[model samples]
Target chain A: AQSVTQLDSQVPVFEEAPVELRCNYSSSVSVYLFWYVQYPNQGLQLLLKYLSGSTLVESINGFEAEFNKSQTSFHLRKPSVHISDTAEYFCAASSGGYNKLIFGAGTRLAVHP
Target chain B: EPEVTQTPSHQVTQMGQEVILRCVPISNHLYFYWYRQILGQKVEFLVSFYNNEISEKSEIFDDQFSVERPDGSNFTLKIRSTKLEDSAMYFCASSDGQGMSIQYFGAGTRLSVL
Candidate 1:
């Protein structure tokens, strides 16, 4: 069984401030990590994913996440946030062989201008 | 940039009523899935369909739940008898040939069982 844990339920940050949303996972087999963002009343949009290769992955919108194998963590970060960045972020994981994604309770990022 | 589409963005039904949520996945995608998110809860996978058959289902997908791909373009999830607890947002997603591919999601159907 695989499970994901997102440490913060809500995060408030000022515009241009750095922020991090922490996620951790546990799985018996190799896993793939993903970050999805949901705007109000909208569907989830894939932000970035860490399948293999580099330990770090980045999204087009300035969000990045690093996959730490030893720490069992995949924490999303943004060097600077904008008001438009406010949204619900979900951390998810799946075992390599299947498409089933185990999602963590979402973290709501509230960016203030 | 094709995307998944779901119908009846909001549904309100009395308890014990049957509800069918519909989805039209990306045209070329082969894998389909259904997931739900209760208010203030994490999203949970309900079932996955591939090759006109169910590939995997979570514990929450009991006998009361069923899925079908009645036509080449449409996929549907049926809840035989919904209870108040069944009120949630149902999301439909689809992905191309799978190993680590990202799944595209629909806007979701909000089912409200009263």
Candidate 2:
């Protein structure tokens, strides 16, 4: 079985400050990693994904995550954040041909002005 | 931008009543899935359907729950007998292929079992 662990349950940052949300996984086989953001009363939106190529993957919204093989981590980072960036973020991992996704408990990001 | 659509954004039903949630995935996608999130909890996978059959399902998808693709565009999830615990936000998703692994999600159906 594959599982995702997001170490932080809540992260509060001032607007325009940098932040990082840590995520780790436990999988016996190769896996795919993804970050999803959920705003209030809205569905989840894919922030970015790490399939295989480069170790670092980026999202159009200025967020990026680096896939660390040895550490089994896929931590999301942003150089600067805005109030609109406040939302619930989830880290997920999938294996076995990507048919299933195991998600973390989720991290709530609060960006204050 | 093609987006998944779900009907009855919110439904309120008494316990033991039957309820069906509907979804219309992207026109070209093949794989469809259902997930549920209880208040203050992580999202949990319920089932996955492909080629008009169930490809995978979690233990939460028991005899009380079933999915059907009644037509080309509509996918439905039926709960035979709802329980108070069944109250949650149910999300429908679809993906075009198995490799890319990017699933597009609907706004979700909020089921409130009273």
User: Judged by lDDT, which candidate is best?
Assistant: 1
Provide the overall lDDT of each model, using Cα atoms, as 2-decimal numbers.
0.94, 0.93
**For candidate 1, lDDT tens digit of each residue in B29-91?**
999999999988999999999999999999999999999999999999999999999999999
For model 1 chain A, the run of ten residues with the poorest summed lDDT: A93-102
lDDT string for model 2 (A27-99, tens) is: 9988989999999999988899998999999999999999999999999999999999999999998773538
Candidate 2 residue-wise lDDT at B8: 94
TM-score of each: 0.97, 0.98
- Identify the runs in model 2 with alpha carbons over 4 angstroms from their true place: A96-98
Backbone clash count for every predicted candidate, in the order shown: 0, 0
Candidate 2 at A40: error in angstroms? 0.7
Q: Provide per-model DockQ scores.
A: 0.73, 0.63
Candidate 2 local Cα displacement, residue B93, angstroms = 0.6
